[model samples]
Target: MNETTLTAGKPGQSEAKNNKMGRLAAASSIGTTLEWYDFTVYNLMAALVFNHIFFPSFSPLVGTILAFSTYAVGYISRPFGGVIFGHLGDKLGRRWVLIATLMLMGVVTAAMGLLPTYFQWGILSPVALVTLRFLQGAAIGGEWAGSVLLTMEHGRQDQRGRNASFTQIGPSFGTLLGAGFIALITYVLTAEQFMDWGWRIPFFSSVLLVVLGLWLRKGVDETPVFKALETSENKADLPLKEVMVAHWPRLLISGSVRIGSDIMYAILMVFTLTYVTTILGLPRSEALTATMLGAAVHVFAVPFFGSLSDKIGRRVVYAMGALGSIIWVFVFFFLLHTLNPIYICFAVVVGMVFQAMMYGPQASFITEQFPTRVRYAGSSLAYTLGGIIGGGFSPLIMTFLLKEYNQSLPISIFASIGLTVTLLALFSAKETANKPLAE
Candidate 1:
């Protein structure tokens, strides 16, 4: 079979017959939203219920710390998930991997909602929770790369950034949804009611959204580029190995490119919630509200920046965003510490918007670094490595840093990391704005 034989381009159709940015964006957004919903809900739970429900035997602070450690467990599992699914996706097809990842995320999350609490089942409860979280981590590890690749490969080459941004909006959308649900539950019920049963609502509700996403994704066509490779029998024999040898430098650079975005995300989305509600004497609803609003702004900023990348180039857009992060980390933290809800909202929303400049173009930018044959493995490996280094330990580190060096130190450290990675990414990669899809 050849590309010509496998494709049904019809008489006048070229890439346009296969590329449909609108359809791809819809599919990608739904898939991304579902996966992120599963991934971030654990963080929400950690912020609130996990300490009491999963680690009840420990001191409140100790239990909270232990529960948050479980959240980090998910990130640790992501790379192996990437390796396994990346191999399968590179070998089988992007569509298969997408379905598998989504199902895994949905089932694990729903089961988590139903798990016995520590009071009911002893330590096995936390053990069960951590194991389920690992599965969600692994599922998301694979889900993100596949979702981004599907959109990018199926979209018009010229608009890859915008299309990919739509995919990345999954996190922003998922974060907002997760926070909103928790907020609503918190608002309607007392803290005792929320811990007793309300937390389960968000987790269990994942089933419906997952089903819808799977259905939408099923209707989407396989990426033309992957189809072309499969038809030509040109799939890489060992995608990970090949990528390691041939594009090793790029894999490193791409991994670093994501650090800035992920660290900012952890700080803005996860840690800040803890900071405001716990440290500043703000209500849980108020902190979640600010985070939710920031996420809403992030949704818009993601696509806007992604579309901007389509015109200006990935590097220029990303560098500007990274520079903003390096500059804003201090100011953002300062405002949050002020304990004024209005200023806190402004600070977080601004941080999220600046973060979006890098995130919006991220999916397409990373995927474009490799050819179709190894795109799945390469992008997944690089992207997950970034997540682990940048996001996985960030919250924990911030918690530790705050304990030792006061509030300002954590932001300073994170900012330094963002600036370092930004420089490395800018210096290492060529601008990929209008580059033709890899052959």
Candidate 2:
């Protein structure tokens, strides 16, 4: 097929095509939501519960470090997942690879609920947990790229930013679900009961979400861009190799742009839970409730910013977000220090909104950098690498900074440095909101 034919459908599509795109976006969103729900739950558990359950022998500080280390292990595996799955999604198709990722994530996450604690199995428990976490990381490594591509490739060109935003909202919705569920569990169970078994329920319940994701995803068609690539016999056989050779700079740009937003998210949603309960002497329920509320705001914030990107441009909105992070990091910690639940909620919610401005337009921005033939591999590699730099070790770094300096200033400076990198990257990137998909 020619580029003309590939782009021809847009000018004359009826309401039927529009309806199909809507359904496809919904399915993609639901699948991504489940994927992030499993991920967010794991991060929350790593922060609040895993140290006690899996690394019981260590001192509190050491245990928290070790727990976050295991959390980092998952992130370490993500790039590998991206390379592997990105190649397949580029060479094969988006649909089956996404289904495979969903199943892999669900099974491993549920298995986490059944694992023996350190007391029951000694060194083996943490080892097993880390192994499962790695696999979970790998699964999500490919999930985000595929989810975004599915929606964007199927969506109207003028609305790609808004459509891609649907996928972006997954993390926020997942955060909401994960935090809300944990809050509910904590509220209902005494601390003793919670430590004993409450955490497992969320992990185990992932099976239900997996089934729903599978059902929803299975009903959708492969994206039009991928379909066009197949018809043109232009699919990349070694997508990663191609991406490395021809698009490395764009990959670096994509990853850099994500640093500020990703780090902000990791700190707000995961590390803050630990910071509040441990340092601020707040109740666990209070922290979780604040996070849940923040995530709820993020669900709306992401799409709003995403749609706004459609009008203004991805880079402008994204740079604003990166700049916001550079300015807001100090305020975020200050609000947390106030020990007022209201201030705490404001901190988390407002911080996430700033991050959302970046994340909302991020999907289409990165995907547009590569041609259809290698978009999956290129975008996934950039995203997962960004996760490694920006998110994987953020909590550990924050913990170390706080422990060594005994103040939030060091962490705020660390965040500022990352956002500065993102701002530089935004300045270097082309405005891609109105670009047609490369053939």
For all predictions, the C-alpha RMSD in Å is: 2.8, 1.7
Clashes of each: 0, 0
lDDT of 2 by residue, 374-431 (tens): 9989999999999898989888998888788888999999999989999999999889
Model 1 per-residue lDDT tens digits across residues 1-439? 2212223456767655545556677778877788777766889788777888888877655665687788888888898889889999999999899988888988999999899998899978888988988888898888888888887776667778887788899998898888887787888998889889888888899999888888878888887778878778899999999999999988998889988888888888888867776667788777887889999999999999999999999998898888888878888878877888899999999989989999988888888888778989999999888888788887777776765665666667765676677668867898777877665
Which residue pairs come into collision in candidate 1? Answer: none
Model 2 Cα RMSD, Å? 1.7
Q: Candidate 2 at residue 230, lDDT?
A: 89
Winning candidate number (lDDT): 2
Worst 10 residues of 2 by lDDT: 1-10
Native-referenced Cα lDDT, model 2: 0.87
Model 1: residues with Cα > 4 Å off, grouped in runs: 1-20
